[model samples]
Target: MTVVAEAPTFLWLEITGRCQLACGHCYADSSPLGDHGTMSAADWRAVIDAAAELGVGMVQLIGGEPTLHPGLAGLVGHALAAGLQVEIYTNLLHVTAALWKVFTLPGVRLATSYTTRPTQPAMRRSRAGRARMPGPARTSPKRSAARYRCVSA
Candidate 1:
């Protein structure tokens, strides 16, 4: 007998591998010098189209930092236009104006992680300043419906 597997309802796309900080616990080994993979905007668009065609209801954009991708806004827009819910996992350290706009889109949401253990001395210093920085609370639109998920380690 053959077993059939159902199509995935949720998908994760690692849009980039570049980040501002290097955390020891990072499973992706993401760092300031991480390689931004060769996937182009067109390539990502095609993937988004294919996922939507496959009946994928949601796509989570993750990375060394997803916001570092230059075409992030366009990718999110394309996914939303294709009727796919978009979730972005980021460090909340380098969100640009364009990316902020994408976060306000109807079908979009944001997630971030914070680690109390500063494995790297540089990371410890950086976290000290970041701890005082207002994250999504200060940047998010007052009337935006986007949901935010915060994970701490």
Candidate 2:
């Protein structure tokens, strides 16, 4: 008999532990003041390479908000370059024009966790989510490409 371990279907890369919001129901308790100082692009590159070697087809980029990571675009590009599907979850709080260009990349899936607490009025923090995040960029089997997914959590 022969045995082979099953490869993981997907993996998560937490690029940052900081966020622009302090949502009451946050699973990670992320805040504007949180810190994710040590990890670097090289570190992420290694992880992506490893997963690809193991036949993991997809990777989810998360954070307090992974968008807040300065090298986010490069990171996404690198992952796609490595032939891995990428998904990002963010409030879409502060997306810039340059970042918008990045979101148009072929394998990137952008999901907006546009949230509202019953106690507090809806906060207009996700400038990206509001203006540009209104439709699906496109869709494919390995990854569902959407510019917006109004997720509440």
| The candidate that achieves the highest TM-score relative to the unseen native structure | 1
Every candidate's lDDT:
0.75, 0.71
Candidate whose lDDT is highest: 1
Evaluate model 1: give its lDDT. Answer: 0.75
User: TM-score per candidate, in order?
Assistant: 0.74, 0.72
- Report the Cα RMSD per candidate: 12.6, 13.0
The digit string of per-residue lDDT tens for model 1 on 1-153 reads 999989999999998888776554356656666666998899999999999999999999998888888888899999999999999998887577867887999999998865554544444245332432235423434312211212222
Candidate 2 — what's its lDDT?
A: 0.71
What is the TM-score of candidate 2?
Answer: 0.72
**Residue 38's lDDT in candidate 1:** 92
Residue 62 of model 1 has an lDDT of 96
